[model samples]
Target: MMITEALRLQSQGSKHLHFLIDVNDEQIIYSNQSFINQFSDIKNPAALLPYIENEDLKYVMEKYLACKSGEKVEDFESRVYIDGKRHVYKIAAALLIISTGQHIVGCDAEDITDLKDYINVLNEHNKKKNSILNIVSHDLMGPIGIIQSLSGLLNDPEKKTDEQRLYQYIDLINRTSKKCIALIRNFINQEFLESSGVSVVKKKSN
Candidate 1:
């Protein structure tokens, strides 16, 4: 009776909090606006039982029951569906002992979808940047090395007697070397600027 009254009061005053399942051994609950909105598609609490068959939720429920049986439960996390859309939830559950030896499990969930998406985007950007750097370093290094080697060969008087041809080779080497250096410098400068901007934005957010 007390559990019923408490649940009723919680449901009435705490609209954002929901009790999705109440079992003999364990229960499922969530207290988050996003979670509530996501579960609004469920016509009734009973409809949520089959959906909770997720591996993560199953693990959470097992741990919750163990804790209620006087076993220690460490913090756990799992993915759950809200409104038919899948989301990663960081969940924490605790056991409450009521009068008459009745045990109640309290659960809380936090949506980490946005955080996960942000991490994925960062990973993809890093992969693309690494690919571009590999191309620049390998493709540009070979030509630059060839230009320097040819310039050295032309500088050796023993190798060639044509002064005009030597001068032409020197000029070509100088122009190509300067262009390569400029390209590298520009790439480095752009990377530094972008890094600085990201740092500034992070600082502002903090």
Candidate 2:
């Protein structure tokens, strides 16, 4: 009756995986429908260790052991593979003691794979945006600085530049301006391709 009530109260037609285990025997006392459906092969709590990703296996095991040792286990997220597909789960567990002096560990696991993936996508996009801004700032500064320097030289009253030299500086500024325009176009194109999930191969040009 205790197991049944606990399962009903925790699961109650929820999609979250729920299970109860005998802490002493490390055996599954009961598993809700969602738990059974999601992990049909997981006979006991110990059996879940193999499914957890190697990097997260130790942390998850630590939490489980803490819960079994009568310690309050805080909720945590872990990555695991289910049927060859990677999934992230937010796990929470509590220890329950029945009237018979038996210790039961009740666990709840909520799948958050989609949420993690979305967050990862947003992070990648943010990184790309910052990278684009840095590259544009660095590349665009060179030609602009050259134009400014040439304009300063032309406007200087102390030094008289000959007509030929003046024409040379003006031609150089025109070429630099055109180069700046080309650079802007390239950056815009690259940003568009990246945002659209297209691969970009960077090449060097004069």
Candidate 3:
């Protein structure tokens, strides 16, 4: 929007960028000071296209065209490159009409680069944590299930029929107990390894 009054200058502050385009004349009418200071090269919509990411450009243009048809676009997130650095922006566009019945599209954009970076890091951490949980649930269950099944036989007097069967069950239980202990150690060591710098070391084979 054009700075016709004193209040207009105060409205466009340094926090966000604002620009206006004349829908009737198909020209960029005005750009706020913050917009000009940051995007000095982008004077018009055509000049701004190259800086917009492919997907973001498509979405923003769709919203811009919608605004021409008297539709409002709000919280439209888009990626734009300013001096080779990518930045996320929350944009809103709306159709505006002054007393003269002149149609204009008012677009407001707020930089949200820091917020987007923080969300991406959180998503990556969630993925790694889920992978560790899967190993604990599936891999460790095998030895535990074997030990539980043999434990029942060892406890039952009727199931422990002969000397040979007794030795077999005892040996199986011993080996399963060792396997379970190793799994527990590995799980604990892995947790400490990622959080700090401590982990279990496997014995080297000759």
Q: Name the candidate that leads on TM-score.
A: 2
Q: If the candidates were sorted by their TM-score against the true structure, best first, what order would they fall in?
A: 2, 3, 1
lDDT tens digits by residue: candidate 1, 1-206: 99988866655454233343334633344333444565654434445545553666567657756766666444455666655776666555556666776666555555665565556556765776797698779868976997978877977777874879878787888888888888788778867875675555445444
Candidate 3 TM-score, true structure as reference:
0.77
Q: Per-residue lDDT tens digits of candidate 2, residues 30-114?
A: 7778887877846667788888999998888888889888887656999989899999999889999989999999888899887
TM-score of each: 0.57, 0.84, 0.77
Off by over 4 Å in 1: 1-36, 40-75, 161-206
Highest lDDT: give the candidate number. 2
Candidate 2 whole-model C-alpha lDDT, 0 to 1: 0.84
Superposed Cα deviation of residue 42, candidate 1 (Å): 6.7
> Could you tell me which 10 consecutive residues in candidate 3 have the lowest summed lDDT?
197-206
Model 2 Cα RMSD, 1 decimal = 6.7
Positional deviation of 155 in candidate 1, in angstroms? 2.1
C-alpha lDDT of residue 83 in model 3: 89
Error of model 3, residue 180, in angstroms: 3.5
Off by over 4 Å in 3: 1-6, 161-175, 178-182, 185-206
